[model samples]
Target: MKSSIVIADDHPLMLKGMMNYLSSLGYNIVGSATDGSTAYNLIVKLKPKIAILDIRMPHKTGLEIAQDCKLNALDTKIILITFDKREDVYKKAKEHNIYGYILKEFAVEEIETCIENVICDRPYFSKELVPNLEKTYTNTDYTSLNKLTKTEIKILKQIANNKTSIEIADDLNVSPRTVDKHRSNIVNKLKLHGIHNGLFIWASQNKDIF
Candidate 1:
């Protein structure tokens, strides 16, 4: 499930705002903290699928917690939030395998996109930091739909025709769970977040593209 998120920031307001924002977006906010140590501990205990952390915090920085997760072989993906825009910090995050890099200034704007990409196994960085990004990560367009596999596109066509997961599964000779997984991958590959009925709507609107 692309749910259960834990967020932490040294600032009380930042932490609160992030918590509320994510909750409003239908994400399950499992826990939140005002310091990095508590944040890391919560991640270890709750085992959420995603961790959103301030780049700098008391006891342990976000990068340190990311390193800890890797050293312990945790599956939680780290999305680092920061005001820092230094290329060095970006490089460090890459070394720690951080899934998303977002600027606090644009957190509210970019976070939904960041989470969408992260859960899909794509590295996401704030567009404001384009200079620090690689070719694929920098300024992208609808062409990202090309990233979807043939089976994924077929599932999407079924979706566009208003087919249910079970129906699509039956037609594709796959399990319902497999169809649901493909739906998720289609959402991620298409970078569709925040929209109601994103998959169905996108497939309905862009039929020619597929």
Candidate 2:
């Protein structure tokens, strides 16, 4: 069966262009949305094999939707299309288990291959971003991350995105105190004592780690 896909983008022209292009490429275009909230709802309802989402959109960013899908254990694979090359954004994509990260400029050239790869359970980072992504990975302090538990890592990613403890708790379906404990443990493990907003600072600076 052809892989089913739902696409979302806030730009009318970009959204139309991508839909037409992907339809021409022989995939089943199951649905499309013009905003992030609608996209998230569509994907969850349709449970398409894949979802192509623009990184920035109304109501919620693609990364935010992807994170929600993951937390809810939804089966739909996520492909985030972005114009940004910032390491922090890339790191968030990775942390949220986004299956594909295609740069907007290369979407026409690379989206087909990205879909093919992700449908087979492989990751697809745009060629233009891979070199820099690799360099960031090489410079990451894996030792520090190794000291953190999986839950701590998840909380840290949320923190890096500037989420408050209450927000993290709500997302993780835990109490505020539980999130606070995890935050404190993360700070201690990373040795971020005696500094104002140390955990926040650490998370901001070490995007590649989480």
Candidate 3:
């Protein structure tokens, strides 16, 4: 059976475009909303297989709604749609185990793939994030990355994206002290010793490579 879906976006045009596109593809759209509260109510009432939501909304953010779903143990998967490319937002989405995340810029093109992946129990993210950085810088050297561990690399990526230690810690669900310790390790691994904000500066300069 085709999976049932409920979608919400504060932007009327965006919501309509998404709804019409998905409906045309023969998916079962049980409900939709132009605001957060209404969207959450619709989800709670209808209990669709998937909820496609705009990340930021008037009454409740998409992350909050996802959290509520988790709190209730609702058997619905969440797909967050947004214009944000912030690592913090992505971290939050992952923290909530969002099934799909696509940038609005590629929403129409990526929607089908995202839905298919989510319904099949796979997670999907926008490809735009990669190309978005590519357009900014042509140097994509990843030589220095082999020396760092995955978690350290993730921290460095967030740092490169300009996230503070507190913000990174909060996003990664770790304490500030843990983040600081990681920072020290990162600085040592990357050999950015004796330079102020050297880790951050290197990450920013080679941000696209991350």
Candidate 4:
């Protein structure tokens, strides 16, 4: 069956253009909205197979909607279209399990393929993001810091202050195992494999960020 989709963008022309283009591509365009709140409501009500959202929008951002969908265990796959190439934004999308991330300029060229891939349960990211995304795996500088989630940052900050995992868990009201899991995720995201006390060392050096 052809996939059902809802698209939202703050830009009227861009919203209409994408809606029409996707319709031309033979997908069922069930809904379209020019504001994030309306778009979120529409998706919740219609339960479309896919949702294409502008990363920046009034009321609620695309990332915010994607997070809400994840928290609610909704089945709609989210594709975030944006001009921003900030690594932190990309990391947040990945954290929220967003299905696709497409650049606005490349939306016409890439959106169809992104939709096709995500509808089949595959993740998609625009080609332009390849270089920077790759760097997050290799670079150890503040750029790589984008890979850390908010909770990870907090845990890392506590670690930088010489707090033990048990102490951090006590302070944050979570179990030490949970704190350790966040540490593991932080280490993995920063690619700190084979390094002794890597997270503590990195956190000590980058304490200024926290």
Candidate 5:
């Protein structure tokens, strides 16, 4: 079956370019919208097989719309598009299990590949953006981890370095309670839940992200 798709973007030219490109690929273009709210409404009503969404939009962000679709139990697979290669955007996309992320300029050429990979139930990160993701990790400072504040990174590095909470507190000139709060914030910001799982393990393995 052809993948039923809804295209959402604020720019008229971009919307047209994407719609034209995808339609030529023989996919069914179910609908198009200029903003996230309209897109969400159309998605709920049309129940498309997949959605191609721009990250920035008026009324609501594409990420917010994706969350709503998930909350409403819509079956549409989402392919989030972005112009900027922002790390926080990627983190949010990962947290939401978004099917694919393609840079807008590359969409005309790379989108077909992204859709195919997503249809095969695989995660698709644009080749143009992988280097940015790697850069985020490699350039992380104990002062500025991606999407994390300076204090958060310091606490995370301390944890990764096998420091106890009290040790971290003393080292950072904060109280143990404050250190614990920072730890909790770090875990939540990184979407790490449960015991002995999530970024704690990932961070330990990639110590340089600390």
Candidate 6:
């Protein structure tokens, strides 16, 4: 029997393309959703064998939906798709224990391999994702960067994006103090303490990938 799967992405063209590709490969295309909320709702009803989720959806990110699925005790294997290629996102996905991680640029054959591996209970991470993740640790000043955690790096990205601590806290569902603590740690780690203007400049230069 073929494995049942659901594909969730905001873009219609990509969504249809993925569905057609997977169908051609002989996997059952159980359903498709254009946003994370609908995906979560459909998974609860459809109970597919696997879910292919796009990372950058509008309502809630693929990461957020994954967490919700896990909390609800859903058994569907998750295959994460992303174009961001950001180390922070990759680290978070690994921490979430996802079944497969696929970069958008990888060949369709690679995606098929990922699905097969994950269905067999093995985790699969595309080769590009691994190196991009390693690039995070190699470039930053390890001695000081060590003081900050992966979560902190995520928060740092939010700050660089011009999000206020309150905004970040609300979005991540954390307390304001937690956000502030992350900011403080990041500033100290980069040795940009008391240098508000330079913080953005430094982050812009580094682009958060070594």
TM-score of each: 0.64, 0.66, 0.62, 0.66, 0.64, 0.62
lDDT of candidate 2 over 83-140, digit per residue (tens): 9999889878877878889999999999999898778655677989866755533454
Q: Write down the lDDT that model 4 would get.
A: 0.85
Pick the winner on TM-score between candidates 4 and 6.
4
Q: Per-residue CA lDDT of candidate 3, range 74-193, in tens?
A: 989999999999877876776676878899989988999989867755566687664453232234335657888889989988887657778888999999899999989977766766
- Cα lDDT tens digits for candidate 5, 81-110: 998788777777767768788998788788
Better of 1 and 6 by lDDT: 1
What is candidate 6's lDDT per residue for 47-157, written digit by digit as tens? Answer: 998999998897878898888887888999888988877777876776565778888878365889888867765566787765545443346564675677888877767
Runs in model 6 deviating more than 4 A are 134-210
In candidate 5, stretches whose alpha carbon ends up further than 4 angstroms from where it belongs are 134-210
lDDT of 6 at 184: 74
User: What is candidate 2's CA lDDT for residue 55?
Assistant: 99
In model 1, the worst 10-residue window by lDDT is 131-140
**Residue-level lDDT for 30 in candidate 2:** 91
lDDT, candidate 5, equals: 0.77
| Cα RMSD of predicted structure 6 | 12.8
Model 2, CA-based lDDT: 0.85
Candidate 4 residue runs with Cα over 4 Å from true position: 138-210
Give candidate 1's error at residue 41 in angstroms. 0.7
Candidate 1 CA-lDDT value = 0.82
Which pairs, if any, clash in model 2? none
Cα lDDT, all candidates: 0.82, 0.85, 0.81, 0.85, 0.77, 0.77
Error (Å) of candidate 3 at residue 92 is 0.5
Candidates in order: C-alpha RMSD to true structure? 8.5, 10.5, 10.5, 11.8, 11.7, 12.8
Task: Residues 8-126, candidate 4: write the lDDT tens digits.
Answer: 99999999999888888798999999899999999999999999999999999999999899899999999999999988888788778888899999999999888987775556778
